[model samples]
Each structure stands twice: as C-alpha cells, then as structure tokens.
Target: MTSLLLVEDDAVIRTSVSLALERYGYHVTTADDGLSGLEAAQTGGHDLLLLDVMLPSLDGISLCRKIRETSQVPILMMSARGDGLDVVAGLEGGADDYVVKPVDLPVLVARIRSLLRRTTIAQPQPETGQVGATLAFGELSVDTGSLEVRRAGQRLELSPTELRLLLEFAAHPGIVLERATLLRTVWDYGWDGDSRVVDLCVQRLRKKVGAERIETVRGFGYRLNTT
Candidate 1:
C-alpha cells in the first residue's frame, strides 16, 4: 500500500481528508501542526506528503523548503486561497503542486496520483538525428539513461518535476512547446489545466540551467535555445 503523510492544522479537514485518502487505498498518517509534520516527514518514509499552507509553529512553505533541502519526495500543498501569490510561493518553496481549499477530494486524489506517477523518472529519447544517450544543449547535459543532469560540468540538484521538464525541452530542442502541451505531457493534466504550473516550473528550471537557454515565444510557448 502507498503511504502518505498529511500535515493539516484544521481538525475537521485533517480527519475528513485522511479518511478519504484511506478510502482511496493509501496508508495515511496525520500531523496537526507544522513542526511535528516536519518531524514526521523526516522519519516517516512516506511515498508522498500532503501539506496544508497554514499551520502553527513553522508554516507549510517553510516546512516544504526544509524537506526539499534533503529529500525529493513529492509534496502537494493545500491553500485556503487560490491567490496567485500563494500558489507561486508554494511552488517556489519546493512543492510539486498545489490545490485550493474547500478541498475537492476527487481533484486532490488526481493531483496526488499525478505527482506519484512522476516520481519514476522516464527515460526520454533524444529527437531524430541526435544520436547519443546524453543530450547536450550547449552547457547543459542530460544523460537519459542514468537520469542525471549537469550544467557546465556541475551536477544540478533538480526535483523530479524539474528534471522531467528539462528533459522534455531538451528532447525537442529549438521547437516551441505550448503550455497546454506541457500540461498534458509533463504534468498529466487534462484540457482545462492551469498554465501557472508550467510557467513556474519553467522559471525554476531556468534558474538552474540559465535563463538565456530558454526563450519565451511571446504569445506562443517556450523553446530551448540550442544556438
């Protein structure tokens, strides 16, 4: 059974969400505050983490950052507000995804499944005419077989989502990839998915790979600059 750690301060929400997730075949563990949540996360050996944004002691964003410093375990943040800033902060703080509160169980489960599915790094094939296990884009190199990424001879510490996003762009090199396409391909989101995830992930990827390597195509999408 897949185990999950849920850190939520609200007693009502904590109970309800844990019960629902258990019904969905997950082994669910709960924590009511951020500090305990962080502690449980460090020792729990959970497959994933469900974190509520507001919590006593540490807050979810800080906890997420602390966890990210050592582990790449998938994190999904829940916020009572759907404000863009909150979502951005959660993502920037190392969450793989975020869900607005008044939580919809079905949607939350879907997001959880998607995050878990991505934990296994897919071996991305290089584009036609490119013949090697390692795909090189100027200073950046992605070794598809070993699932390692390096920038200018230095290994980059990237989350699974970030590495997958980089691989998608590296495989297509120079070709524009629409946000919607990325939503489906990279995140496994259906047609009405939020583009913010794509944009934010791109921003994070650029910071590691260098901003100049990825070109924004105005109203189109994004392309990995091979020149």
Candidate 2:
C-alpha cells in the first residue's frame, strides 16, 4: 500500500481529505501544524507528501524547502489562492505540483497518481538498447540506466520532475517541443492542463543545467541547445 504524509492545519480539511485518500487506498499520516509536518517528513517513511500552504509554526513553502534540502520525495502543495505568485513560490520552493483548494477529490487523486508514476519511471530507458547508456548535450551528461545527471562532470541534484524534463529535452535536442506536447509526454496532462507547470519546471531545470542550454522560442515553445 502507498503511504502519504498529509500536513494541513484545518481540522475539517484534514479529516475529509484523509478519509478521502484512505478510500483511494493510501495509508495517510496526518499533521496539523507545519512543525509537526516537517518533523514527520524528516523521518522519511512516506512515499509522498500532501501539504497545505498555510499552517502554524512554518509555512508550507518553508517546509517544502527544508524537505528538498535532503530528500527528493514527491511533494504536492495545496493552496487556497490560485494566484500566480503563490503558485510560483510553491514550485520554486521545491514542490512538484500544486492544486487550488476547495479541493476536488478526483482531480487531486489524478495529480497524486501522476506524481507517483514519475517516481516509478524516473529513469526512462534510452532508445539505443544499450545498458547504462549515457547521452551527452555539450558538457551535460545523463546516465539513463543509473538515473544520474552530471553537468561539466559535476553531479547535479535534480528532482524527479526536473530529471524527466531534462531527459525529454535531451532526447530531442534542437527541436522545438511545444508546451502541449510536454504536458502530455512529461507530465501526463491533457489539453486543459496548466502550461505554467512546464514553464516553471523549465526555469528550475535551466538553473541546474545552465540557462544557456535551453532556449525559449517566443510564442512557440522551448528547445534544448545542442551546441
């Protein structure tokens, strides 16, 4: 059974979401405050974390950052406000995805499933049929079998989402990948999905892979620079 750590301060939301997730066959451990949530997250037993943006003692963004410092456990953030700044802050703070509150249980479950799937197939196989195949883009190297990425020979600490996004770009170097394509291929989202996830993920990937390696093609999409 998949286990989850849910951190939310609202008693009503805490109870309802926990029960709903339980019905979906997840083992949930709940924490009502940020400090407790942080403590539980640090213990490292859960497969994923579900966090509410507002909490006592520490905000969800801070907790997300703290968790990211040592772990790459999939994180999904829930916020009452869908404001751009709030969404950006959560993503930049290390969350893999976010959902607006008045939470739709079905949509939330789909997001959870998507995130979980990424973890299972985090290191996708290369097309060469070679074990330990490594693909190079300039100074950046990705060992698909080993699930490792090194830039200029230095290993980069990337979240699973970042790693998968980088691999997608690496596979089709110099070709423009539309956000819609990326949404389906990388994130498993359909047409109605938010494009901001792709943009924010690209921003994070660029910071680690070097900004010059990826080019934004205005009004089109983005491409990985092979040179």
The candidate scoring highest on lDDT is 2
Tens-place lDDT digits, model 1, residues 55-174: 999999999999998988888999876577778888888888889998999999999998888876543445666655888889888887767889999999888788888888988999
TM-score for candidate 2, please give it.
Answer: 0.95
Residue 81 deviation, candidate 2, in Å?
A: 4.0
Q: What lDDT does the true structure give each of the candidates?
A: 0.89, 0.90
Provide TM-scores for the models. 0.92, 0.95
RMSD in angstroms between candidate 2 and the native structure over all alpha carbons? 2.1
Q: Residue 216 of candidate 2: its Cα lDDT?
A: 99
Count residue pairs with overlapping backbones in model 2.
0
**Once superposed on the true structure, which residue ranges of model 2 sit more than 4 Å away at CA?**
123-130
Least accurate 10 contiguous residues by lDDT in model 2: 123-132
For model 1, name the residue pairs that clash.
Answer: none
lDDT of 2 by residue, 91-171 (tens): 889899988998999889999999898888785555676787698889989887888999999999998888888888988
